[model samples]
Target: MLRRTLAAVAAAALAFVAPVQAQAPAAAPVEIQFWHGLPQPLGGLLEKIVSDFNASQARYKVVPTFRGSYAETMVGAVAAFRSSSAPHIVQMFEVGTGTMMAAGRAIRPVHELLASTGVNIDFADYLPPVRGYYQAADGRQMSMPFNSSTAVMFYNKDMFQRAGLDPNAPPKTWAEVEAAARKLKEAGIACPMTTSWPAWIQVEQTLAIHNQPLATQANGFRGMNAEMRLGGALMVRHMQNLVEWQRQGLFRYGGRDSAADGLFPSGECAMAFASSGLRARVMREARFQWGTAMLPYYNDVAGAPRNSIIGGASFWVMNKGPNAGETGGRSAAEWRGVAEFFRYIASPEVDAKWHQDTGYVPVRRASYELTRRAGYYAANPGADVAIESLLRGGAATDNSRGIRLGGYVEIRTIIQEEMEKAFQAGQSAQQAMQAADTRANAVLRNFERQNARAAQ
Candidate 1:
């Protein structure tokens, strides 16, 4: 009788516990924070990508936060790192490559992170120039190239017709470009030509496309002690041309960075030298027909049409510290989540869509092929100009490969400042470039001093 009573009591207890267990809520998904700098539709698209990833799996949730412009975003990230509150992933512009690479213990290299998390993304699968820009000296990829772009010529076809110029035959040489600009001016165009990213389009890309080095030691790729060589013959000639054009009212000096991007779409400027990524914005805002072509080159230079270097930013993963039960470094679960998110974004479908939607060149070979096979490039004429320009010479030379200089952001500012002074203050182009070279070298030396331990 005593055994039977005990059995009944145990069975009742088990039944009550099972009901309570069944009513318990499931564990919350891991939240992975991603910080980036792209604005507007790009940021919205990125968020949608995160949403899709979250919907695809229940174990992870990625939240994308747009910090600001590229420069602001980088500054914010640095501050966050100092405070030990950095996000899992941060988008950094290409010029900031050296800074990110030298940030020892603050970054977790993409290669190392992927390996630790058992994610297999072959760096070889990415475009050569895209992958090459973010690689360390040993060729290990340091970050993930996301929005890769190259400088290209965007011109108003209607304006060309108005100027009695051939709309289809865009200018291919600097001489031809000058002639066209003059014709447009004669046709009563207020702003015959303008360029965004003066330092990048007029200086850096000019050097790269002409197969010239922006700095010594293979543009700082070989070592950190490289010095500026901007006051060279070619740079002087180009700067002088720009100054002359400005004086003749044939070219308008757009503000720094992408401030001049609007002049083209608003139909004020007939021609623009800007990032190929501007295609999307131009397509959206322009009421008249527009076309794109490779950037005009100096035909007299040897290998005059060498490949242009990439301009857009890449995604850098951050490291907090060693994990201490979630209070320090990223946990293994978080790393897995990040790796999964990267794999999702890098897949052919996602990458190709991103390239198509944002006008960014496809970073991965598979993505490019997939888009081409789908007839995307054919449907969107001139869309392939960026990739073509990047692959112009078949092989990247030391000068045309890519710039990897430290403190290049500040150096670019110095270039723009000197160029402005040359345009407005009556300073000779030669003198301005010489000043730029001197000031920029000081920044490089300071960066070298700060990162001396990296060399060791």
Candidate 2:
């Protein structure tokens, strides 16, 4: 009888233990590393998106690392790739598109990556300009468009009123811009006008807006033999005007890149030609009323004010593997996780939220429609200026589409250097234009040579 009792107790213990063994803890979610180049509030907003995504899903946790400026981030990503420790995604500026496209075995086209995981993204949902900028020659998307922006005029309405200019009317032409600058200067405004990304605003976007060519072969889209066309009559005239304005204190040369972005918000400069993305910063930091308008043009050039091209960065997926441009040894599940994360962000609700928060043009048309329906544009006047500027002209011509040339980052540096020399009276505007053309062409030729070597 005692033996039977002991056997019954053993059977109960075994049943309890079996249930406990069957209920092992779930596996931890996969972690994805994303590197980007955005400062301050923008970076904080991006993290919020990632955090919300993590909370919604149990499969992946995305960790974003701010990798300094665009140039620094690109350099770091390249080094990471060489060391076989690259992050899954990197935010590369639009100018680096050519370089990223040429990086064999280093990048995995997002379309292909998603399709491999049974997820097909409809590129049609994205805006044409935003879509076209990142597409391959074969119509395949090379990367995911994020934070796309264009140049615009940001002016302080209070200053405009004080300067005796029409506060409701912003400058519409280069002549008008100059005239307004003079008024602002006369009104005791020390820094009447300044520009961020001088090369982009004064050169690339200027060429596109005026329907001028920056390079031959349809702005380098046709082939790699495209040469610089920087010394045109219009460019020379515009550069000369900038130099004259600087001399008269109508315009101030506020350093390079985005270093001059603060001048407007800090109330130091009354007017600024800067990225539309500056809307977010200006809104948060500006103490006075501000307004945004389309970039000014010369009006004499045929098809002038065509459209401005995108200036912000895109998300590039890196493939760091030993194979020849194959997968990065990531498991199928992991790729699915990445695809899922992308799908979540690309949804209309999430995308619209990002656009509204960051001052970037919505990549997806659906997102724009959603934001409009939600009364975002009505509540915030001038928020749609970027979109309107991009769609000002009918269809984007070759001149207004975008620039795709290797070593463009270096070329921009060269242009800025030459322009600085002109502003300081070290060289004439005409001479600066000629020097930039010559030096930029050399950089292109060197890029071609490097590409040839890599292919062989």
Candidate 3:
């Protein structure tokens, strides 16, 4: 009787535990690290996308790490490559193209990487302006365009009304912009205007919009031997104009970086020049009525207001198995996982959502059409201004296609530093451009020497 009672109790306990054992989750999938520069809400959006992708498949999990700013992230990735501890992917700003392209052993081009994994993604589906920027000279894509943006003008509608300007009619040309700025100043607006990425917005992009070149050698697309032409007549004149505006209180010098992005939303500046990607920030932070318009161009300059160049970042797959351990390459599973994640990103639905969430120019044609059909543009006036501006400019030229130069981040810094001297009255606009070009050329020359030797 004792034996029977003991056996029965043990059997009952076993039954109770069996169900729990059966319900235990399996080991998690392999994780692929993705290093990026997005912070806060943008980071949250990326994480959600990763989570969604992970849930849709059981093969891989993406681990996203927030590195510092765009420049910092690129530097860190390069360092990681040297140590053989780089992530599976890195988000590189548009300016990093030349460096990334020259990093011959540091990355596997997206087209080649996906092909290696037997995933034949259609490269033609990508929006031309966005894709063309990352493509190689031979027509192969070098990286994936993730979040491409262009310069746009943002103005406060209420402030326009207060300043007695047409709230419905933002300035279409730089001449009109100057007149409007004067009115805003007369209205007692604290800061009439400011700009983000002064060098990019005021120099390279501005040059391109006017159908002018910033550099020789096809803006560094052909080879490493390139030189800045920004010291030319047009650029000097533009800088002189800015100097005058500053004197008249029509333009406020917004720092070296994107600090001006905050001025417009804070209701301090009546107008600001910022990235189209800034719409997400403005939507969240601004409490007053605001509107976006085409980037103001000089009406007197022929071919003015050409398609603006991209400003945001792209996805670059870090070289797999840089150390290569015992294996000759990364595990096939890892390659497969990377390809799958990329496909998820390329999906039209995903791209459309990205366009709607952030005012970035859609990188896919299908994505743009989908977003339009879904009534996103109908509900959000002026949201598609970036797209329209991109289409307005017929085709990209050697000057306008995009800049591909080594040490571009440093070059931008040089331009900014020299421009600051002009603001302080230490130099004239002509002197600033001359100094900037000199400094920028030195950086480009150093890059040319390094890469030239490496090639040999």
Candidate 4:
């Protein structure tokens, strides 16, 4: 009787312990790495978002690493990928879309990953123009659009008032801009006009605003077989105007992007052409009252004043490693996470806050409407310029959507160098543009041939 009682008690204890062991949670968290170019405040913002995501979930955790600027981050990712140690996602600039897409089997399409995981993400809800560049010809999204921005004019209200120009009415055409520059210069303003991202603000904006193509085949939308078209009459005329303005003491050509930004925020320049995304930085740095305006257009050009192109970056997902799973495979759970993240980021409230903070256009129509209904535009008077610039009912021509060329970042550098020669040196505008066109074509052709072979 004693042995039976002891055995029964022991079996009961064993059963209780087995149930507790079976209900215990698993060890270790799934780590997902993200590499981005945002620094300081923006970087902090990203970390906060990731932290929130982690705290809201139990299975996966996101780790964000700042890998320097966009170019540096891309180079680092390429090197890391070769060693099979890249982050799950890398943020690349808008100009890098062609290169990233041509990177062969290295990247996985965002759509494919989401569909495989049974996550329902509506691509149509995203703003068409903002997401268009990252989409395939058939309209499949390849990357996640983040920090999309367009070029705009920045002017000092006090300077305009002092120059006897209406502070509320900014220049609407290229001719008016020149007149204002002359007025500001005559009024003894030290630097009447300057610009940042010369290639982007001056050349790219100039091309788009004038409704002219930057390359053959509608700015490379057709394919890699396209050639540079920067030597056209419109381009030459614009360069000549800038060169002439420099000679007339109405415009100052700052060194490059950083130098130009310094000129504007330091109160040395009364007017500038810069990215709309610079609003936050300028608002923080500028001591004077300032406002933004739509980029000016040439009067003679037919269908002029088309939408400006984007200058920021997007996120691309890598297609290898545990996250990517086997060939043609992505783990259902991982895909679900990616899709959820995208949907969360694209939510109306999230996009509105991002746009309000970063000065980037809200990537959803409802976000814009929500902001307007909330009187964001009324509180911030000139804020609608960027939205109007983008959504104004212009036909979706290839030129207006912006360039889609490989090795375009290097090509932009070449353009800057050649334009500097024309504007700073004594080289004729025609000569400078011709040389730039020749050099840029070489890059385009080289990329075309290389990518063609890879495709085959």
- Candidate 3 lDDT, 326-368, residue by residue in tens: 2213455565677889999889998889788767788888898
Question: Which residue runs does candidate 2 get wrong by more than 4 Å?
Answer: 1-25, 322-325, 453-456
Cα lDDT for residue 12, model 1? 51
User: Which regions of candidate 3 deviate over 4 angstroms?
Assistant: 1-28, 321-328
Candidate 1: the clashing residue pairs are none
Clashing pairs in 2: none
lDDT of 2 by residue, 1-456 (tens): 777566556655653553344344575677788999998888898888889999997767788999999999999999988887888889999999888877767888888888887886778888777877787766788888888999999999999999999988999999899999999999999999999999999999899888899999878876678999999998999999999999999999999999999999999999999999998889989999999999999988888878789988999988653342334645455566777778877888888998998899988889999999999999999999998888778677777878888899999999999999999999999999999999999999999988855533
By summed lDDT, which 10 consecutive residues of candidate 1 come out lowest? 321-330
- Lowest summed lDDT across 10 adjacent residues in model 4 is found at 321-330
The regions of model 4 sitting more than 4 angstroms off are 1-27, 321-330
lDDT of each candidate versus the true structure: 0.88, 0.86, 0.84, 0.80
lDDT of 1: 0.88
Model 1, 89-199: lDDT tens digits are 999999999888888777888998889779988778887788888988678989988989999999999999999999999999999999999999999998999999999
Summed backbone clashes in each candidate are 0, 0, 0, 0
TM-scores for every candidate against the unseen true structure: 0.91, 0.90, 0.90, 0.91
Specify the highest-lDDT model's number.
Answer: 1
